[model samples]
Target: MGLPDYIPVKGSITFLGKDITRWSITDRAKAGLTLAWQLPARYEGISIRDYLRTGTKGCSERDLEESMDFIQMNTTFLDRAIDKSLSGGERKRIELASIYLMKPRLAILDEPDSGVDLLALREVLGLLRLLADQGSGVMVITHREDVAAGCDRSYLMCDGRIVLEGSAGAVKRYFMSQCRPCDGCEVGEVMRRG
Candidate 1:
């Protein structure tokens, strides 16, 4: 479902400079440009810090420190354990930090902030802005209004297709207008998942 075509059938997905649709999942991930699954993987013997360092080589203490602070602000479980002991929100942040460490030219995050609380969402939003500012094109697949609003541009998907493409404000207005109780409706509802 993370591929350009989410048809649930055999297909190809290219990432970074590689055409990974033909490669093994592990091989493709090593090439940079990757997806953080909705559910984070658990490695019983490894600590969170060690797990990150495993995938990101020669990672500076400063980078890890910055990432730790960023992850902690957005997720409370990162500094905790990975031994089936972390909460959903915590796991999500860990996965996000791992993805951020990959530092791909293009990042495709699917429902990146799904399990997080409000404060975490704020931190994630700031991080996304920072990534965009650093010249990375971020494609955030989310239903959250806050996520969409934080983006430089947004694409509205309906019926498994893109229904609208424009600045976030335009998309928000189109959604709000189509909804009932238009005048009192909260724009945030646009991004909320069930």
Candidate 2:
């Protein structure tokens, strides 16, 4: 995905056998590619239902219900605004639910497990698998062991570049070895200030 105010030094991107290396974000979207960012953006005046309706044009009530169910969301949230009023978990779930309904040709999920619980994480994985099985390409960028392990292959990215690419187990082991807590760092800090 292209980041705003920054251009890729060098890279080639192809989606569904089409070269999209120089395509704009709008163009990629028009070609059925979508990205689910790690931090879901909030919409000040948009309702959850309205936001989700963008996933599928003229979305029916039953389809929306099914999508919400797939993401383990309560249908009553339809009227809620897409803003800070919602919890991080709730926002993340809505984003995933939208992705589920979008049915894009390629869905790039960045940290799908960031704000989700065990069950929601499982649902996210299931959604990716379902998408792949249905002829869509799903790419998940996650650091969680369980999440990465679900993939057929995995790539370890370090310093904004790939350091390893192989079986999920191999990359997972390498990632763990390099994940221990260290002094003068907060990578694994979990306790409250004493």
Candidate 3:
């Protein structure tokens, strides 16, 4: 919870077998822990290609093109600035492509499925599966059952606490049966009732 603020927290956060509870955001990133924001930030002057190449060393042109293809993005996006000109879904896909290039040891994606179309969602799901199979630990924060279903494990959080966690199928079932539309029901209330 205090990750961005770098506040001293009570819990332990270990990454790649090292303690990172008190690590700064930059340190955490350098340690191969990446958080893809739900709303990705805009970098006015940076081209999408330059942005994707940030943490990716020794990446070839083919590798970059392949990453974009994996996310179903066109090569034309490479020269465009990572700014407000891009749609939310475009930014999300670009962010995902960057993560794919980085191949971090742990990837914490916040609502990656939000604003994405069904086709793109499937591609994202496939990429996520591939990332997991390639040995990166992916923790996707989402309420979507489809996204959860693709995950190996799922954790349901309510009122800032994880109330249920298990195999994706089990957690998805509990979420679908117990929680109403997020707009129609408060998570705390659902937690209390369940």
Candidate 4:
């Protein structure tokens, strides 16, 4: 989606009851809206601690450590450069930690479950729930049943359009039933037939 672009188009985007469609990305960040990209940008020279501290101005050392702990990150990572040196899961966790520090009013995560093992996936889901509990609206885009299960509502999309929207369980059940593979079945064809 073009949400992070921070440019105006045909549609309007409202956050916290205000129109932010034309707001600059910096402005949106200042207004407590943030996005965690699926493949976060690499900061070759910036240490993890420096990067997170930049986002969490005035936060004490204990606060930073607690944020890392919430995401299950080892304290050692704080000294490492946020570059290719880190594993994919490590990078993902660090990106999520940034979100926790920013404490955005709304967070849009793009495929948070991708490339991570089951254990990391569970941690991501836990952090997402924590964000919601902390009053941030989380919008997760994922195809994984477990991720959807962790969400309050789920929307099934086909060809860029949502074909189903309901409680997570209902949407998952419907998707499983309708999209299951058969000898000659294709997803688009099955969707059309259904």
TM-score per candidate, chains pooled? 0.69, 0.76, 0.77, 0.80
- Top TM-score model: 4
Q: Write the per-residue lDDT of candidate 3 for residues 27-140, one digit (tens) a residue.
A: 998888888776676677889889888868898898899888977888888888877767766777788888888878888877777778887788777877777777778878
> Which rank order by lDDT, best down to worst?
4, 3, 2, 1
**Residue 10 Cα positional deviation in candidate 1, in Å, after optimal superposition:** 10
Q: Which residue pairs in candidate 2 have backbone atoms (N, alpha carbon, C) closer than 3 angstroms, thus clashing?
A: none
Q: Tell me which of candidates 1 and 2 scores higher on lDDT.
A: 2
User: By summed lDDT, which 10 consecutive residues of candidate 3 come out lowest?
Assistant: 185-194
Clashes of 4: 0
What RMSD does each model have against the real structure? 6.5, 6.9, 5.4, 6.1
Cα lDDT tens digits for candidate 4, 1-194 = 41232344467788879998889999999998898777776777888899888876787778779879978978887888877667777778888888888888888887787778888778778888887888778888765666777777777765434678777777767867886542332222111100
lDDT (C-alpha) at residue 169 in model 1: 78
Using TM-score as the measure, name the better of candidate 1 and candidate 2: 2
Query: What clash pairs does model 4 have?
Result: none
Question: Total clashing residue pairs per candidate?
Answer: 3, 0, 0, 0
* lDDT head-to-head 1 vs 3, winner: 3
State each model's CA lDDT, in order.
Answer: 0.63, 0.71, 0.72, 0.73
- Model 1 C-alpha lDDT per residue in residues 1-194, reported as the tens digit of each score: 33333354654565655567678866765664566544566666666777777778788766766676656643333455577666667667677677667775666677777777787778776776776676666777766676777776676654344567777778878877764432422223222111
Model 2 / residue 15 / CA error / Å = 1.8
